[model samples]
Target: MSDPHYDREAEKYESPIPSREHILSFIQEKPRSKRQLFDLLALADEQKKAFERRLRAMVRDKQLSCNKSGVYRPFSNRGLLTGTVIANPKGFGFVALDKGGKDLRLTSQQMKLVFHGDKIRVRLLNKKLDAEIVEVLETVKTLVGRLHLDGKKPYVVVDDRRIKHNIEITELIDGCLDNQVVVVEMLSSPTIDSDAKGKISSIIGNYLDEGVEVDSAIYRHQIPAVFSEKALKESAQLPTKVIPKDKKNRIDITKLELITIDGEDSRDFDDAVYAEPTKNGWKLLVAIADVSHYVKEGSELDSESHERGNSVYFPHRVVPMLPEAISNGLCSLNPKVERLSMVCEMYIDPLGELLDYKFYSAVMLSHARLTYTQVNEMLEDKKSPLRMTFSNVTDNIDFLYGLYKTLRISRQKRGVMDFDRIESQILFDNKGKIKDIVASSRNDAHRLIEECMLMANQAAAKFLQKNNEDFLYRSHPKPTAEKVELTQKFLTAIGLTLEGGIEPESRNFAKVLKQAKGRDDENIIKTVVLRTMKQATYTPVNEGHFGLAFEDYAHFTSPIRRYPDLLVHRAIKRVLNTTSREPSGKMIEFGTHLSMTERRADDASRDVEQWLKCEYMRDKVGENFHGVISGVAGFGLFVELSEVYVEGLVSIRDLKDDYFIFDDVHHQLKGQRGGKIYRLGDMIKVKVASVNLDDRKIDFIPDFG
Candidate 1:
């Protein structure tokens, strides 16, 4: 094919042979070398350089690739894939394909071209699925880390382990001292020969200072910590108490002896519940804070809440989605206060099946603010002092407990997968240091409130579906085949099996858990089973939640904290008072954004907890403690201390008189020579070796003479 745009090229350049389009079309069928192309085009010596420059530009733009043998070929769309880079601290990385299949592995050399969380295109190498970076679509622009000074050279060590490279500090602000946590703005991206360069944008504080972990996590995860001035102004203007106009056309349930049951430390109460014995079975009323009533759509408060998505609860503090003026003041369902609410009233038969439900706006008064401990004591013992103290709500507690038992029967019959994992509470001293870490027990009171909230959420989803309204559903898809296979292998190694062959329901998992109960390795079995399930997320497509075993489920209970619940509140109101329907496109956008924010909050909180745990163990080095093998990896074993509820790693090298080999299927390390095995769930004594605050890691070794 001759140069079709040769005349046009000649008008732009003095020595022009063919346009880029012409050259590409000619080489599209078969890749050609530069010399071959020069001979084919019959180009003069002077024009060769210009043509070569074009080829290099095309290659830079990923339009073409030059093989090692010097052949230029156009990229086939099938040969390239787009994905987000998931980097490891070890310098190797993987690309999670957008369309969802097995991830493509990237070598350390290739990982140097892109940072973690960057979206990029990769070209498949072979059947083994190794990939090469083709082009970066997006790059991480900032990082959060601690500043380090090596003589005159200043650099930043990123807090996120997934980011491997140490960013060179090109500029530092005044008063930004070494070893202090700071946020860095990327000046240049990393390359094969050099590290990424950045400037200290803002100093968080001293790395070891009290409450610095929370601040660092906020910046590290890019979570918005401060509300906008407009949002604050709007919140400050909100009324402290519910006005009479706010109760217009809404049911007045202020006289009902409804009560809130939460943890002892909980401050922002969003839900109040009441139950009464009825002829059919029971009548239950769940009143949630009407946050939507005050935070109108398109208002600054609403915008700020949407951005936050949900409250981020830390061990010592909380980053609320809404301002305190709304979340803890006007919208909070505090005791003896008139508060606007969105109520879900349900009628259930003796069989525990939901018979009828209705949703409406209401003015509710919480008669008492009860803690879980108080409620449990009142329900567990008739002569309990709490019963005498809260005599007014004694009948209400009995009614709620009866309803909860019936609901438990229904939940068990439906095969709800329950993982009775022991949760730990990190109690802090007055000096803001960890005083003690203890197991937080869950009682019947907790179950009662959870069941009530679940019913209300279900009713909300059912209501929206019946009205043909588009909204976000809490969706939990089935596990991937790969994860399921690994889990099955682990189960089989332990003389157990997941009942479902390929596509199993929640009941199958519940059955496996039931069989594993009372066994010594029950926690191990439950942990492996839990790992096989997919994470639940908000989506407009309504895939249904596999974990909760719900056909229809939406968050309708905590509008004061969760954005999806707020959105659910708005959707319900739209159906009740107006005929307007939110577009499906907008719903999808909201789902994705809210899901991301939820994950961000989880990551930030986890980071803070890990840092605190590391700090707590800093002074405990050389002390021996017994622990259970929580995890087994090729390099080490992760053990959780039975006494303190802290986790640390015992490196394979630390094992005595054995060359350990990792057994992935059995979740253990086997000795090649000594025949000693360190398996998951095995209790072993270990001595604390060291703690790294920067990495939030603790090292332990076997305590042996």
Candidate 2:
């Protein structure tokens, strides 16, 4: 008496069903309705219930999903987007969209299913761009962390704060111990329901071990520490000295009395300079190491150099972009050695304007290697020991300083913004622990080299533009309108005005800085204006450099350490030969990649420096020091100690007298009950309360007592 269709469906539910693989293969070939899937799999009448259960299980596993019309398809085909997950330290995460749309935000619950840097497929849930993780496509395979043992249970707390989950350890490599820093390799990636599993690969060292801080930073940031065998082999094959054939079409400028000026610790000399007074004004020759001559394009060495983007300079060491064989051996501008170079011969008029410039390959011998301190002494005192030591080059040094002054005037007239912020240099003792932190002084020697480099960069940009070649330009965009408005409000609070209207040029900002030069708040004002500007990046497009106020600029020096400069050398070569080059699209992609690598290097360097600073301050807890308020937040003020240049938080709760309100517009924190205010650049005394090495954080309290 029941319907015949019911009888048939019931009969089908009694038959044996196909395996998941068989069903999935059928669905993958082509999407189908449930009825069609049953027919396609050729299931018996008795298999209907089993088939339905299997379909539901697949949907639950995110292998398949059903449409509104009740048609089944692969989950990836159901309008899910793929992206890399960027997790926050507070548990939330965002999917950086691959197709260049707005990022999709994931809730804490959704973020639990995947780790930071995991590539996943996501589906938007609402108009707010909130997304649900459909599937994890790829997981971060390696991590650096501290090993911990809970009784007999072992695990790793990853150094990257964004990776919220602790990795359970299944095994340990030789020499690994609890509380030691180790690198772990993921044995199993996290799923929707379970945590990740890993095995310790190698032990870096103990938490408080000497040099371990720098090692931890290196691993934490995933900076490449060693070159590949192929790259090293290529470097080894490079000639120990420049061959005679290499100089065949190169100009001979070995008698120009060129001198290399660099830091006392510098080993790789990338550039040398010489200047002389000409009939017009001056002739300057900047000879840069011809790295392109040794590291040919598309070679293994070139590939590695491009991947590095630029050399990373840390307090105690450098991660050079090229191998030592090339960077410090064959290509370094060593004194009295004939080396190949790419010279930028520039002519400047009496008014500091660039009259003309020509780029050519040449051979040169460096007369001497000079340090900044030595050169400064020679300039300040005629009878200085350095002056007597390098007597032959004293006349040339004087002329270079004269040219630098002219260039400085020109730079000021062009409205270039210069922020005179104090940079700290960490000095290490014999045991490699920090001896002291001192302010890095910049004198005329540094400025002379900088202006020379700027001129060469501008010349390169001009030459490329004239030839209509595709190349990477160093471009700095102006500040956003919101930031500009905020800056204006803050400046007005300080009784200062920003000239040139709402769309003021960089010169307007320069004027404001000039007005505050001798004021007690000069550093604070400069810091604020600097924060309101955008970071410079490499681009194929010819946007002007806003900070430098240059209409066109390109990095053409230091090819030994920067990949962009090497590429620039290649581009210049092609232009000189009148050869057709690659299209602009390719250069644009390369520019974007190089810019990211540059930032990667910077982040790694900064991470190491922070860790070192934290270690240096660990012993100073309970001590009092003078500090300046460097940053203000809703929760606290960040005070940078004047003695050690280390910054720590002064929590709002410690203010004690009243509830404080953060003023975003004026960049200050005001107390409601006490009517007290703490603003940026306020000099105050503070006592260090505690240091947390685990979080690399320090806490401070005002010395009100």
> lDDT: which candidate is best?
1
lDDT by residue (1-705, candidate 2, tens digit) is 122344445466554466666667777888889899777767677778877887877876878865434567677746889999989888899999888788999888777778888998887766888887777889887888899975567989888768888888999887777799998999887644567899998899998888787777778766777899999999998889989999998999999889999999999999999998999999999999999999998999988888888888889988899999988999999999999999999999877889999999999999999998888888888889888789888887998998998888888888888786888899999998989988886888988989989999999999888888778999998888888988999999998988766677999999999988988788889999999998899998988999998999999999999988998888888887779475468887889888988888887788778778888888999999999999899999999888888889999999887899999878899999888999988988899999877677889999996
lDDT of 1 by residue, 439-558 (tens): 877899999999999999999999998887878898999888888888888888888888787788888888888889999999888898898999889998879888888899999999
TM-score of predicted model 2? 0.89
For model 1 the local lDDT of residue 601 reads 94
Which candidate has the highest TM-score of all?
2
Q: After superposition, how far is residue 496 of candidate 1 from its true place, in Å?
A: 3.4
Candidate 1 residue runs with Cα over 4 Å from true position: 1-82, 97-102, 121-128, 578-583
TM-score of each: 0.89, 0.89
True-vs-predicted CA distance for residue 341, candidate 1, Å = 0.3
Kindly give the stretch of ten consecutive residues in candidate 2 with the minimal lDDT sum. 1-10
- Assess candidate 1 and give its TM-score to the true structure: 0.89
Kindly report which residue pairs in candidate 2 clash with one another. Answer: 11-45, 11-46, 12-45, 12-46, 12-47, 12-48, 13-46, 14-46, 15-46
Query: Residue 455 in model 2: shift from native, Å?
Result: 0.5
Model 1 lowest lDDT segment of ten:
61-70
